[model samples]
Target: MHSDRRVVLEVKDVSKLYRLGNIGTGTLSHDLNRWWHKVRGKADPYAKVGTINDRTEIGDSRYVWALQDINFKVYEGDVLGVVGRNGAGKSTLLKVLSRITSPTTGTLGYNGRLAALLEVGTGFHPELTGRENIYLNGAIMGMSRKAVSARLDEIVDFSGCAKYIDTPVKRYSSGMIVRLGFSVAAHLDTDILVVDEVLAVGDADFQSKCIGKMNDVSKSGKTVLFVSHNLAMIRQLCNRCIYLENGRLHSEGDTDLILGHYLTKNSDTARTFEHGPIRKVEVIPETESIRLKCHYKVDRIVHIPNLGFVVNNQFGSSVFGNNTLNSGMSANREFPAEGVIEVEIKSPKLVVGKYTVSIWFGDGQEDFFHEPDCVEFELIQKSTSQFAGSAKVGSVLTDCEFKISAL
Candidate 1:
């Protein structure tokens, strides 16, 4: 599919090296050594000694390669998704592409103007008003004052910060900064948009708007590079995906194919026990409630066996949890040697998505059995409410009553 499209960006043999424990080569001697190598037209003396950027393992080397030997081509109008574990160089790659940092080893070729939102308040001056920062960003992107002025109202409205547009960005909350930053980047006259996980700081509504804006940008023949851990958003936005591991491009291809491989490789199956007391578990989602059924077998007698479970979203964050004792249920007698335990989570305001269930069985004194990600299910919205298809903010929905009164 990429064969027919024009290549808007190309990354060739790119790598970024950083010295451990200190910035810029760590010492005067090391800096001199690197300078000496550069004067002699030799490759970086430290670059060769840097280890791959793997945070899990302790390495003997003092230098680490944040990104190494990366190569990829982004076609015009392509929405490329970058996925990786936390320290897998996704951010480094985007920084290199965005020109926030230079690659240690290779070059980046850009066919058009590039704008990036790598962090909250990435290009904003804290003392500057949000309105002023918008113009500053436009100026940085090489846009004229008239052009920026033409889009100022649209940008401010999209950001939802009109009430505080004249206030200094220092006083703006993190979420507000993100809203303005994203709005400026999207509305600016840039040909390629690069966004990191900074969108995670925004509320769900802003995130949905950012996603929609990126889609519009792509449809307008601009390229986009998105880095996110949210697989759902990645699947929804990207047509092509690249998986990074240990500072390298592990694989790149169709989004679903790459996501499947990534999930299979990084699945939390290792956290589950092989021979636990809980023999089987099932998580079934219904219109109004979620049903959790656990079948267990135990040889020893357990007094007042308490059954508890936690529901985690796809990102492994605990959404909510409940147990027999906490829910005002009484199981004072001894538990059966073998039996099925059924639990109905009623009226849970869960966002529509996939979730995993982790179970714990124990008495009031101690925990007897525990398993993480024991079962998985999807929550579907059945009510025909006005906000049914809107992007949800967090893991669970809130039931709040609103009141407006005049003094």
Candidate 2:
């Protein structure tokens, strides 16, 4: 469907480099070296020497590549989602695309005006009133005074800050600031919108409103680039996604495919788990039942550890959960030093979709170990099932028997 749409934004071989310790090259010698290379019309002497942006390891080089040879295109009306761990360079990629900072290599091509809400109060002056800042932002986007005035009421109403529209922005709370900033960006006359994780500051209702507005914007043939750690929101808002790892685009495709890959990979390495007794967790999803195999190693002896698990859907909502105590297991005996626990949940009645498992080991008195999103799996409906190929009605299927009685 997107094949015929015009490309609104193009990023070709884009990369961003940063020095480790200080803003500039620490030594005059390095500065001189860079100048000499530039004077001779040569490539940056240190551009190719930086390490990838991995925060866990102590690197040997002082230069790191926040973005490396990134390439992608945003078609008109596309809502592209960017996902990654903290140091995976997601923010850097957004900043580069938003033109907040220039790439060290390659170029960006834009066919339309761009407006970004990268940070809270990104273009707002602290001393200016909320009412004035809206006009200021419109001016920055090249809108005329009359044009901004025409949309002023809509912006203030959408922000839910009409009561304090004339208050100085410096006095506004963080949530207020985000509301006004997002309102201005979304209401102003712009063809492309670039939003980072700043929307997380707003309340839940406002976030929902913002998502609805973005959806409207896309339907009108505008483009959007969104970055957030909230996988659930990404799944809901974006039709396509890109995963970044170590300053490079690791994968890009359909939203569900990328999210599945990310969850499975992170679980396999236990990267999201805290150091504890739980070593590994495996989940097997079936039409009739769900199987869980947990591996654990205990260093200190504790009175009877109760093993439990909770199954949650992609939206982070708990579909169902249980612990050993509730399953008629005795809690009088002590836990083994190292062992595996296997659990089979019969007739789970889960609807077709993806789910994640969170495991916890704890004594009746105190908690010992816990891991969230330790494993992820999907459930497929059988061909003979009544609800096969039907639209999802709820998170779980029910076995209700239908009958009618005459009153």
Candidate 3:
């Protein structure tokens, strides 16, 4: 991967910073001031930045660094997946590479025709019909009219919008618009393609087509930079991936391993709770024969914030669990000390896997649990059977049978 096979893009220490100020002349003044400093051969006063989480006030000038000290290189034919939480700067990074916006600091160097499907039909002409927009978008991406015409039928068919190929894109549904837009970009004879998660389009079949198209693009020696929240898709589409957190590169590695780390590290349940004492509790499992019995000693009045648990597989991710306070029947009962409390979760549709559980008591919204330790459980195969001895057969168990009611 490190070999010098026409390294197209080299982004070194790239940073994009935006300033905050009262609108109008104040913003004008700040921009002029920064420019004036540059003319004097002196360094820009804003060149140095403070910490990421630095505090600011109404009167004090503030800034946000969308991309911070980032560094990565894309070789020809590499498909790189960029993953992060919202506001993690994944989109900002793509914009920088696509040249839609410039970095506040650092540099990006690349050699190739780079086209981005950032937002659906971003460069489309609302006044034009679908047929017209195709040529227009192609030209905008540095493609000649001849190229667009050559791929016209494929684009229209790929979008499954051929019936509406002559219709104005403005009247097209968002999903249709996305399909057409991606179809255009995918066919562009570009060396690199930058895509942000605009694939929530068409249907499941169309989504699979787009993913397969990207797979083909990488196979054809064209580079791709894909950004998406769906880790499953990222694992399948990319061999290498970059994880961004708080506007900086957090991790980069094999797609599966990197996404696995990113998903857990930045997951919603990544916080610890603080709570005290539990009242009445209910234990529920889908398994009809299985039962859970619990005992609690309440010495004083205390609030149990949230009950939390983790579902883990021997190799990787299973599930992360949390109970909404007072969720379901848990809110209706109270537990007194020195008594056995039995709880039943009827027909829990749990997938076959190992599970860990933790019960907590604290403030409102699961601030903390009774103790830091979690309870554990295991679920073995039951109604499970294997097909040719390969594919998974059952997801969850249910005592289900059927007979022909009518012919």
Candidate 4:
């Protein structure tokens, strides 16, 4: 048994293995064959071949390891973020830890109760009403009816779905469904919580509420296991992070450092966008950072191209955008085949989030290059306000003029 003072959860040499082309078609026949062989007291011919625990030797030896010898310990009040690219086995790891699926090998030990929000609507019953499903989900998590009832109002209020408490969950919108399901999971008095990257579905407000709740939960001394593509949120909520890559633990340490390694390891970068013969783009140093500066030039032999920029937030919301033509400004000159254009600004005036810079080079006379999305950046905000207004990382800087008028 682990302890809050020590480690609350420990996974030792844990791994999950699945067979290839080994999916069930006639399981009953296979079972009968095994039973018959056992009754005869003779080893089944396919036994050794079919049931090997070696991940490398399984499934015609073409096996995939969703997790490979993972080891970690989470202490009470520790929030651990598990991040990776798509198909990086992040969800599979959570499934194993949540006991939704059993590991093929290794032992997992935990002292306190665990509640998992693997998918937003995982525990929700479409036929059941919100009020009923709350109790149902609580019971599923090993909570008593009385405990669920005690927290029912809080859950409903938190979900902001009180008016539809008696309505069937099937009638709820996808957003509402996810909200209520997460609320139920959040309210459970568990020693640890595991949430997958599905939080990307909800609106901004709902996401904010989820983050706030997770913060409060962490403060109350519960262990947290979070999986997300939102690097900013992960960095803010988790101090430590584990990076999974191709079914293996790539790195484990501070959130920023781990994510940095994860990104550096798995980044797939393309040069630029291709709209037509008139326009093209090439990223200078596309990695992860808030501030970005680029050079755009047009051919003097052809038409003069107009350049524009759009700065967006992580959620793809266009916070601000401007173009040289609309601003009644020009690039000061035209391009000579491959001339240099310098555009700089102190960027990313939003929370710590992934942002991409959209560049458009067009003739404006007709459509030189059309609006072609180019350049990507990841903005990591400082941990505190002390770092605010200190250093700018993007192009463009503004001097704010403040004046006080009193009557």
TM-scores, all candidates, are: 0.74, 0.76, 0.69, 0.68
If the candidates were sorted by their lDDT against the true structure, best first, what order would they fall in? 1, 2, 4, 3
> Quick one: ranking by TM-score, best first?
2, 1, 3, 4
- For model 3, residues 23-118, the per-residue Cα lDDT tens digits are 442466767988898899765566564335222323243666767899988888888999888878889899999999888778888798887888
* Predicted structure 2: clash tally: 0
Model 3 CA RMSD to the hidden true structure, in angstroms:
9.2
| TM-score between model 3 and native | 0.69
lDDT of 2 by residue, 230-296 (tens): 6767877888899999899899988888877776665442323346888778886645788888888
* True-structure lDDT of candidate 1: 0.85
Cα TM-score of candidate 2: 0.76
Q: What tens-digit string does per-residue lDDT give for candidate 4 at 1-407?
A: 23536788999988776655767523678668867887997754333443333333334543456677889888888899998877677898999999999886688998888888887578788999999999888887789999988999999999899999999998998788888878888887788988887677787778878988999998998888999887767877898999887677878888878977875654421244343443344333323223334444454444545667776655666766666667554545554565444444434244444556676666666555544345555555445442323324333334468899999
| Candidate 4, position 262, lDDT | 71
lDDT of 1 by residue, 1-407 (tens): 77888999999999899888855556789779888989999998777788889899998898899999999999999999999899999998988898888889898888999999999889999999999999999999999999999999999999999999999999999999989998998999999999999999987777878888999999999999999987778888898999999999999999888877786566443233457577777666656788878888877776666889899997889999988877655354556788888888898877766788888888767888877777776543333242424434787778879899999
Candidate 2 has an lDDT of: 0.84
Cα lDDT for residue 141, model 1? 90
Clashing pairs in 1: none
Error of 4 at 384 (Å): 7.2
By summed lDDT, which 10 consecutive residues of candidate 2 come out lowest?
382-391
Count clashing residue pairs per candidate: 0, 0, 20, 10
